[model samples]
Target: MCNQARFLAGAIFSLGLVVSGCSSVPYDGTSGMTDSNVRTSIYSTLDSTALVYTNPAAGAPADDNPWRWAGFVMHPIGVGLDYVVNRPLYSISSTFPRATGYTNEDAMLDAYRQR
Candidate 1:
């Protein structure tokens, strides 16, 4: 009836708002070192998972065994989490200078340079 129709309209409007809020823009970790795009974001996420799981860093016990398979299994889940949760959170926080933890580009660059 009328109530059902109104509920459906409200649901659709809410879905549209949620979808619009999600951004595909790749996070610029290095202040324009690379292009920002959906593809870059996906690649970076996957690459990070691969690097962490495949290369265990110096003197970390080279097992070279079954643990590596976990990375393959987790990569998709990690990517999904990044896209669904992390990216949207970053997008929202990046809008506010205080939220981003840097007042300006100079401060950000200095912090990175020191690291």
Candidate 2:
């Protein structure tokens, strides 16, 4: 009975870690996230700037057997989870802004002008 209790607790903890690990939303340090227009504009601009430059398919020329097998197992799981879980979360998150003021453009243009 004690072993069973320990196993149950461990299982619950593992599940919590997995869920919490993936569950995060973008946040910039500002308050008053009540304005819909500001949220929409900020979300749009941030989306444009946050480009995925790294090619997902690009990796080391050779991986060992374990890595190859791990990737084989995890890649499809990631895609499936992304479609079922991440896509909807992303859509919902886009409705909120990452920053309350000063977008990426503002910072970049200002730096350019200074230089």
Candidate 3:
């Protein structure tokens, strides 16, 4: 009976994941549907473009570690899961008023301008 219950729970969880994963709406930065709304950190254009090219082409030696290969396989899956779970929550939270300080874009741009 316990085994049957566990299987049923797992099936339900899988179904939820499948249903939630079908979001077709593109993330255009703003939390709200309008451009006037400030962009939230949940999905940042800056973050998606945050990759740094520290080395020249063919400059760095590849690691021979097995775990490095495992990470290479898993990184995209983890990032996708993080986005699927957090994006809606962030959008919901953004509808509420913030307590203080500038929005994320303003703060980051201001810091960059200072430098």
Q: Give the number of the best model, judged by TM-score.
A: 1
lDDT of 3 at 59: 30
Q: After superposition, how far is residue 56 of candidate 1 from its true place, in Å?
A: 12
lDDT by residue for model 3 (1-115), tens: 9999999999999999877764675765445556443323333333444334332323323453577789999999999988998887776666752543438787689899999
Q: List the residue pairs that clash in candidate 1.
A: none
Ranked by TM-score from best down, the candidates are 1, 3, 2
Clashes of each: 0, 0, 0
lDDT of each: 0.68, 0.65, 0.64
Off by over 4 Å in 2: 1-63, 98-115
Candidate 3 residues lying further than 4 Å off, grouped into runs, are: 1-60, 98-115
lDDT of residue 58 for candidate 1: 36
Task: Name the runs in model 1 displaced over 4 angstroms.
Answer: 1-64, 105-115
